[model samples]
Target: MVLNMQPMRTDSTIPRIVICGNLEFASAECESLFKGVAEVLVMNSLSSADLIEGMQPGGRYEGAVGILRQWNGFSHMQRAFIEALPSSVKYISSLGAGYDMIDIDACKEKGIIVAHTPGVGNDATAVTALYLIISALRRFSVAERQLRAGLFDASRVTQGRRDPTVRTLAILGLGGIGLRLAELVHAFPMRVVYHNRRPFVGAPEWCEYYGPGRLDEMLAMADVLSVHVPLRKDTVGLVDEAMIRKLKKGAVLINTARGKVVDEEAMIRALEDEHLSAVGLDVFPDEPTVNPRLLELPNATLLPHLGSISSDAQKLMEVRGLTNLRDLVLGLNVADLVPECR
Candidate 1:
């Protein structure tokens, strides 16, 4: 795990880079971003033994673009591969803001630089959260299903949508996406409150800040709750049965954050008891395979992790990922290095 903070041999030469694991799920334009600027290699997702052939070090590939989704919960051999990368390879770039999937400690020990698209996904993801909030509040999913089932009587759909002006929105994490979503919804004159590790200084005048000690007060007061936190040890299962009990009855919950952040069974139970009116989720506890109970719930809006799925957003993320690689090749401060790495 030799660290290589020094610049690459020169700036004029094209850096040889490799795209590891699955590529089909990535943006279609991803490969073209490095055209004529870097020698690119595509490697299929394989177990440790399979990666040995044709994956040698020493200028064969000096940079790697790792798809976090593909690398989620990487195997031990994969960790070894990353740490044992050839001397020529010194940079690893993840597609988006979350680097939780990659073995960052291994990269750091190897003196490898890691970077991601920090701000590229904010707008798209915020828009998805907004969409979920509107749909869940209005119960549009239930109405659509009933309509498709030949029960088109508009009277059957409950007029349960809460007026934004009368509702209080409590944002759990006021990161990039949370701030953007606040701007998007404040037009409705919704009363906004947010809880963060520390108060967000220089916040908009309309938004209220709640420190950790005031969480119970915020939870009890919110008519709609939107979670925008990252997946970390402290946040996994952060919202559980006890926390749900604190929410306003019939409150709507929107989670565009990581699935593991909320307790799924507890949420399902609360929904079943009518304690929660509706739930909207773009992520799940076990991704690609959702809880069957959530699928059966009439009041739940489930999506296949669509936070950053837009074509435009996809391209922007790839461009940013590639740009980080370009910057490393030309010797620039890694702008989006994860805080822990820095």
Candidate 2:
């Protein structure tokens, strides 16, 4: 339902923008930025049904030209919801870098421009990955668990732990987050190798680039394997049992990217047999409900999808999403369009 938090201008000539989710840090900034430019309508929607109903003809958001969306308890912006959008809705500015939740195919059919905040969360997510890498390699979580259980044997917990120094760190995807992670790991003096569709021309000289054909070779040589690929049709279950077996035995695994990119069952089996010394995961295949087996593993360092929740990252994402909507309303080309839309 549309929230009448403030008086909205009735001028049909003025463009209307709807905010689908609450901004934790940038609410005031959103108001100020679009004060004189467009009529900002806040949507108090509980589910996709509410949003779909509101976007219908002669509905509350019938006149909205743009929507700034965030995670509002809905799983995705599927084709059904997209089809319900009024003809006036021309733009969708999403809050995060990943636009997998939105159906790009549907948006394309409707001629709706989609934009996402890409670089805003890179550093925050990279730092989270770096922390996981160190924690997993050093067996920090295992040590903490042992100490908490009153086992107090430092020698036992530290028996097979390894350091990040002088190790080969293989990144599966060399996008913004992966590149930032490589730079962070370089400080530890770890050798970095990245696999991409093609060579990243902007990659640092010290970073070794491995083409798609050499993915298995890169995996075999890695002391620590970090998955950074986005979740897509081709990437779901990309790192399957065979790929997990390719990694050197006892190698640490880190995944800050989407969880479905790696085969969760295969990864769990590897960890169970001690083929992987440890694993650090920030994202899970099924969020808010992690596997019970993973929770029981001492060598696993798990985070509740906190990779991009830093205060700075949160504010930047909010501002970036709002800016995309603002730009589109002003007839300016929006930046950070999703790959499919681009």
Candidate 3:
């Protein structure tokens, strides 16, 4: 995709916003959406360190939008960027659902605003999670491999399928995407249970809610466990060796959540030991690079984080991020402000 940076023009007293990270984040279409509302700056040519240093302490940067795919986790460079945000920059809107890379605390402490594209990607991401659930539980990958290799014709083969309608699905996180997953999972043949920080007040009656130190119970009850939590201080490696061992024997593990949420080595051990029947993953601990061992495993189904790649979802996300920036610029309440920023 051709990336362009429009010359800074002040045709009116419109807001001046900065767009950072990869050229893909500041797509031409994304920049076009800001027309007549804000002056968009695409800082693709600048390195992260340069981005941080380019900001003058008193510059008139009213807002910033980030679509950093390579920034899988927050680092000192990101912290430095957050610290260097000009005083006029009231809000920093990120393109994706997770804002773990953006320093919420720094923004809150500085009285600057930060927002995320939360629900825009829900439908597509939830569908991807459900796809993993079915593919992992039913051994679709292995069956496909054998069929393509002519093993299916060479010998009689049989594998048991764990019907979703017949088993209970435990959703590990009940946030936007998780709730969407629950909405779809409830319609399937299986029962649904979810664990969140607190019991969701208005969840559908058919869906069960578990909270306040009930992860183990959730793990035990799950015939198919799908993780949906974010990566945070409390969630990094949350599912460790001990936790992996808590699964019901011959159960499927589905993680569309952050890969760091599950202990990769422990998970591999569990798979080898037959503690976990099969595993499906979208996000990995590292992006564009996965554990080589996982690729070699026959019981694992891997996806290259195709959760929110849908054009519809991506455009909506860009609109949402721009909306937050525009709203904050007008001194109005940002509809999609992160809780910490609010």
- Rank ordering of all candidates by lDDT, starting from the highest: 2, 1, 3
The candidate, 1 or 2, that scores higher on TM-score is: 2
Estimate the Cα RMSD of every predicted model relative to the unseen true structure: 5.7, 2.2, 3.7
Off by over 4 Å in 2: 1-4, 7-12, 154-156
Judging by lDDT against the true structure, name the best candidate. Answer: 2
lDDT of 3 by residue, 1-342 (tens): 324466356654676676654444435555565667667665544455555555554433333433222222223235567677566556676777777767778777767777777788999999999998888877788788878898885323446556677689888877788788888877776788888888877778777888868878888888888888889989999888887788798888888888899998999999998889999899888777999999989889999988987777776776677666666666777667777766
lDDT tens readout by residue for model 2, 226-341: 99999999999998999999999999889998989999999999999989989999999988899999999988999999899888999999898998889888888766888777
> What is each predicted model's overall lDDT from 0 to 1?
0.74, 0.87, 0.73
Of the candidates shown, which would achieve the greatest TM-score relative to the real structure?
2
Worst 10 residues of 1 by lDDT: 1-10
Provide the TM-score for each candidate, comma-separated: 0.84, 0.93, 0.85
Better of 1 and 3 by TM-score: 3
Candidate 1 structure quality by residue, lDDT tens digits, 198-285: 9776679788998989999999999889998888889999988998889999998899999999998999999999999999999998
Task: For candidate 1, report its TM-score.
Answer: 0.84
